[model samples]
Target: MLPNKSDSRRRLNATGLSTGDYNKVNTDTTETDGFVNEQWVAPNVEEPIPWKTIAIILVLFVGGTICICCATLDWLADVNQDRSDRIGALTIIGALTIIPGGYYLYILLCILMHRTGYTMDDIRRLG
Candidate 1:
């Protein structure tokens, strides 16, 4: 047996929605429910300078400089295979550290100097 349309509508209305109500569009434009037509705006707060990152780069640059200098001095005085190998390894490590450290240090200096298009945010994004 088929259920009556009125009975079905009454059951749906009891659940707080009628069948035809789902198809109806809200035509009212004047109501503001606190969030209507809201646009997002970025906050105007300034980011703090990244002191830790700068410090780390400075450490790497200084450490790499020391490593390369010591390695060069050691190479000039050394004749043994073990010392030469150690000097070569130190030079490699120094180069690895100095390359990125120097690049980022240059970027940071540019940012500090307020060069156009240079930003600390770029360094932050690299990590």
Candidate 2:
């Protein structure tokens, strides 16, 4: 007489256990549980401000404004004194100051206006 399916399964299981003395332990079960509890994930961060660039811009702005003011003062002093040599010298100096100062001021304003909220895309677009 042939044994039933359950009887055959029992015989196979008994033989497998006897042949291999190693135990079947679920090691991954505890490791998976610990990983779920920890819940590790990366975070988002903001980009740093370009402070050195800003400092350089401020210096250029201040220096240009000072040059313009100095030239204006010299011209005014010459006009008061009523001397042709002094007037010619001061006029030339003032003209030189006005041109470069205006250009520098415009550049500084552009920089200030475009200061914040910049990315690689924005810089590419600026070109």
Give each model's whole-structure lDDT: 0.71, 0.48
Give me candidate 1's TM-score against the actual structure: 0.63
Candidate 1: residue 57 lDDT (0-100)? 89
RMSD of 2: 19.4
Question: How far does residue 57 in candidate 1 sit from its true spot (Å)?
Answer: 0.7
Task: List the candidates' TM-scores in order.
Answer: 0.63, 0.33
Off by over 4 Å in 1: 1-42, 79-82, 125-127
Model 2, span 76-98: residue lDDT tens: 67656656565566556656555
Judged by whole-model lDDT over C-alpha atoms, candidate 2 comes out at 0.48
Candidate 1 residues 1-127, lDDT tens each? Answer: 5322222211124445644552322335343234322234456789876678888888888888989998999988886655887899999999998888898889988988999999777786332
Error of 2 at 114 (Å): 9.7
